[model samples]
Each structure stands twice: as C-alpha cells, then as structure tokens.
Target: MHKIAMAMLGVALLGACQDNNVMPGPQDGRALFMANCAVCHGADATGNGEMARAMAKPPKNLTLIKVRHGDTFPRAKIMSIIDGYARSKTMTGPGMPEFGVLLEGDLVPFDSGDGIQTPTPRKLVALLEYLESIQAER
Candidate 1:
C-alpha cells in the first residue's frame, strides 16, 4: 500500500511539472506589448514612454519618417533586434533588457504548474505588424 501511494504521488508530481506553453494571438501581442514594451516603447509604439527620461539614451522615435531606413521599415531587422538576436551599439542602454531567452520558444516549468515561460511568436509578429502600421511614410 505504501509503495502504491508513493508511485501515485510521483506520477501526480510529474504531471504537475509539465511546461505550460501557449501560442499567443494578435490580442495577446497587444497585451504583451502593453505589459512589457510599453514602459519604454510607449503605448502608441512612439518610443516616448514614462521611463524615457531616466535612461542615458532616449528610445528611438519609432514612428518618425526619418527613422525608417530606405524605402521600407525593416521588419525582420526590428524583430531580430527585439528578440536580442541582433546586437547594436545604439540599442545598448539600461532601459532595454535582452529578451532572447524569453523569446527562444522553449517550454520551462514554473511553480506548481501554475505559470510557465513560453515563446510568443504570434505576439512578436503582431508587434512587428503594429510597428509597421505606425511607421511614417517617406
């Protein structure tokens, strides 16, 4: 009886330890942006967030026409940079945190299976789309 109880407990614990991974949608992207990016990137994606003044380097005005390179805003470049896959001297500052690990699309267990860190590919793509939507035309 004792051995059977222990086996059941172990199985229960194993099930509880499973990683909770969920794919986000466009609304999820907006929520994620508002929660994580809005503090530095602004609610409008304008780069004029509340923390803008405390940092040594001000965030880029993402909506400016001059900010876009060439004829089109580089979407892939922006995504890579946000994911921390791309490194830039200009992107360095206290305000920006490296998000590569968070964006790596790995499933990791959290406390009591209540929380987990999962990749938000859709959210990321949506964010890029949002940025593109707001980019000033040349």
Candidate 2:
C-alpha cells in the first residue's frame, strides 16, 4: 500500500513538472493576432486599425510585399520592431509597446514551457509566422 501510494505521488509530481510549452497553431495564431495585433495592425493584418486615424501617419499595410523592406520579410527586423527595438521614423511617440513584457502575460500553459522563458523571442517567432502566412505571394 505504501509503495503504491508513493508511486502515485511520484507520477502526479512528474505530470505537474512536465514542460508547458505551447506553440500556437494556425487557429491560435489568428486568435492571438485578433487579441493583440488587431488593435493596431487591423483584423486583416492591413495596418488600418481603428486607431490609425488618430496618428499623423497611418500604419503600414502589412499585406503589401512592395512596402516590406529587404528581399525577405526579415523575421529579425519584425521581431526587433515588435520588441520596441526599432522605432518608426514616420510615427510620433513610441510606435508600439515593448511587447517583450506583454507577451509573458499572454502566454498560455501549453505555449511556453517556462511560462515565458523568452517572451519577446517567442512572440517574435509567432508573429513572424503569422506574417508569413499572410504575406502576398511573389
């Protein structure tokens, strides 16, 4: 009886200790975008969110491949921008929030093993994937 109880306890502990990494699937990506990026980037990733009117310069139309800098979408560049590492010259004030901190708050149990080990990096990857999915084909 003691051994059985101990074994059960060990299994329970192991289950609790399991990693909680949660990678966003297609649906999760869309949902995440709607909740976080849509407010500024628009529901269609078009950069014409409702808040754009208040700004001096409207947000970029994300679907436009022509407007994208560099030959590729440059995941690092996008990540830097989202992390607030890059600033928009045309826009006044901080163009976007430093989502490095915010991503941690949004993490679900399955998406991040350590909850949010490197939120900015993880969010950058996820956002890049989403952008790639929506990018206009060459």
Candidate 3:
C-alpha cells in the first residue's frame, strides 16, 4: 500500500512538471505584450501609450516595422532588440528594458529555410507572431 501511494504521488508530480512545459501559442502573444509592453508601446502598439507621454522621447511606432524595413519584417532584429542583445542607435536610456528572462521558455525549433534551424523560445515566437499580425498594411 505504501509503495502504491508513493507511486501515485510521483506520477502526480510528474504530470505537474509536464504542464509547465506546455508551449504558449500565438493567441497568448497579445496578452503577454499588453502585460509587458503596452505601457510604452501602447495598447494598439502605435507608440503612443500613456507611458510615452511621460518619456523625453516617444516610443517607436511598432506598426510601421515592415514599412520601415523595405516591406520585410526584421524578425532577427526584433528578437535581438527584445532580448537586449542589440540596441538601436535611436534608443536612449531605459527606453526599452530587456525582456529576456520573461521571454525565455521552451525552445521550439523552426526551419529558417536557409539550411539553418532557429531555436526560439515559444513565448518569443508567439510575441513575434502577434507583432507580425499587427503590422500596418501600407
């Protein structure tokens, strides 16, 4: 009886661990962005959030990302910027805080279609999808 109880408890614990590994989907992206970025990027992601009003410089208009990048969304650049690995010249002190820790999660492999696989966090990928979906059609 003791062994059976212990086994059942182990199985329950294992199931809980598995639940934590479940990857976030694209649908979760908007909520994550709202919670983490809306202060400066705005609810509509137009760079006019309430926080931007208090800053010395207004945040970049995220909707224009593709338009500014010659009609191609710069995924790598966006990821780097979010992770604080790359900082744009236009960015000043504390304009964008690093979100690496918040974005870190299960790495889901994606084929870049150039013979290289990109191991990206599920959260980051979802966030990217959300950003792409919100790009202004110009």
Candidate 4:
C-alpha cells in the first residue's frame, strides 16, 4: 500500500537524522516542527520551504503571527487553528489538512494567561510555545 511505503520511507529518513535511533520526545516542539512541519513551513518557521512553491497557496510566514494579531499572540486561537477546529469542514484537506490528529494525546492544564486553566494537549502546547517564541517584532 502507498501508506505503508510512505511509512517505511519516513522511518528511513528519521533514522538517517538520529545518532541513537531514538525518536523525538512527543512534547519537544522544535523537534516536532522540524520533523513534521519544516517540509512545508520551513525550518525557521518562514513560509519559504521548497514545497511552498509547488502549492497553489504558499504557507504562512509564521513569525508574523503576533504582528497580524495586534501584538498579542492568541494562544487558544492558535491552538484551534493548528488542531483544525478553526477550519470549516469544507475548508479541510486543500490548503491545510486537519491536524486534529494532534489532539489525540495527553492533556495538561494550560492557562491562556486568562486566569482559567484549560486541559490542553501537551503536544499542542509545545508547538504553540515554539510558535510564540518565534514571533517577529513589528
């Protein structure tokens, strides 16, 4: 099957990048991004990856998220976008596929600095934290 072949290819690529043959930690955001996202979003989180040129719509220049959001990095909002809750059903699978698959993991208390703690997924939080750290000053 195509999926099986892709899985084998993925394993080979990952193995070539490691020293101890260990997988990246589930909550290691930078590792997560480089492995899963850099192909489309670029290692620096810019929208300049090689695949971007082939797509009908280029990926977002992620460093400007805070600038576009009025100088505040909206944590909950970003998480929704990442996990696909922000996308309508009709809007799925083209420009962006549903990453709600990322939601299927452990949860931890996350405060959006809003005085309320949400039971957020650790993986989502890790990725979100990494994105926030890369905000370009505007």
The candidate scoring highest on TM-score is 3
Candidate that would win on lDDT = 3
TM-scores for the candidates: 0.58, 0.61, 0.75, 0.71
**Cα shift from native, residue 41, model 3 (Å):** 0.6
31-108: candidate 1 lDDT, tens digit per residue: 667777789878887788999877788877877733557766675567676766775656455857865434544333
- The per-model lDDT (C-alpha) reads 0.63, 0.62, 0.77, 0.76
Ordering by TM-score: 3, 4, 2, 1
lDDT of 2 at 116: 44
User: For model 2, what is the C-alpha lDDT against the true structure?
Assistant: 0.62
How well does candidate 4 match the true structure in TM-score terms?
Answer: 0.71
- Spell out the clash pairs found in candidate 3: none
Ranking by lDDT: 3, 4, 1, 2
lDDT per residue (tens digit) for residues 36-60 in model 2: 7788779998888877777666777
Instruction: Give the 10-residue window scoring lowest on summed lDDT in candidate 1.
Output: 105-114
Residue pairs in candidate 1 whose N, alpha carbon or C atoms collide under 3 angstroms: none
Stretch of 10 with least lDDT, candidate 4: 18-27
TM-score of 1: 0.58
- Misplaced by over 4 Å in model 1 are 1-28, 65-67, 89-93, 100-120
Model 2 clash pairs are 21-110, 21-113, 22-110, 22-111, 22-112
